[model samples]
Target: MHLLGRKSKKMAPLFLALVVSLMTFALAVPAIQLNAQKLGEGSTTIQSPAGKGAVNFVLDNNNPDNLIGVTVSFNETLPAGSIIYVKLYNGGTLVTSASKQLTADLSAGSGIEIDFTSAVPISDFDRVAVVVKGPTIQP
Candidate 1:
């Protein structure tokens, strides 16, 4: 009778451990499925231009008819009389271009915002590229 009682006590812990492991596996299964669904989306990468400046901007879908618009911001400390040129391109074609000249003394982290819209339908293009050229920054 004493040997039988010891064997029964050992079996109790073994049963409890098995039940706990199964519960943990059940809870983790749904979280794994949710993360797998998010992996299908795509992302965009922006390349900084030449010179010693930084361009930080956001692309927003403004018009319902045209699905693309870009807002550009630049930070640079340029001399009082410096000229900067900005260009936008869709594939190999030039879409829009702009230039600016600084009047007063500018700071190193100073920036400006510009918006560009497409004349033709945005859906016609597969990829879009924006290029900047000037004395201060490039992105």
Candidate 2:
């Protein structure tokens, strides 16, 4: 019984060391940050003449990030050949616009990202707008 007690004492240190190593590994793991950008244009849900979806706008911080893109999440599938228009506006005037036509049917609740063909500076616009020219549906 004493021999068994000594063996358990020895095993306690190994167990403690294993626990410490696992804790250290857990602490060393880096955090996951999604779309870690410098600035964001906020998000909103909009009902379009063609369809409905939630839009998230992201602004370029020029942290080598000169590209602007729009993320849209619909409650239903968006059919192929549907066109999504993303526009930048300065006051009442339109600064620039980018668009993409859906190549395949986008699944419901799945978000789609449409990026500008070329770099468009965020400094040129204060307002962002999205217009969908496709099917009429509710979000």
Alpha-carbon RMSD, candidate 2 = 15.5
Minimum summed lDDT over a 10-residue window in model 1 is located at 65-74
RMSD for each model, in Å, please?
14.1, 15.5
Model 2 lDDT per residue over 33-127, tens place: 78867544678665443456787765566654454777877777878877888888899998788888888887888888887766666576788
Best by TM-score: 2
Candidate 2 has a TM-score of 0.51
Q: What TM-score would every model get versus the actual structure?
A: 0.37, 0.51
lDDT of candidate 1 over 1-139, digit per residue (tens): 4755878888989888999999989887865444345533477663443335554443444645453333333454555555556565577776665555657555666675544554435554444443444344334
Error of 1 at 19 (Å): 96
Local accuracy by lDDT, each model:
0.54, 0.75
Clash tally, candidates in order: 1, 0
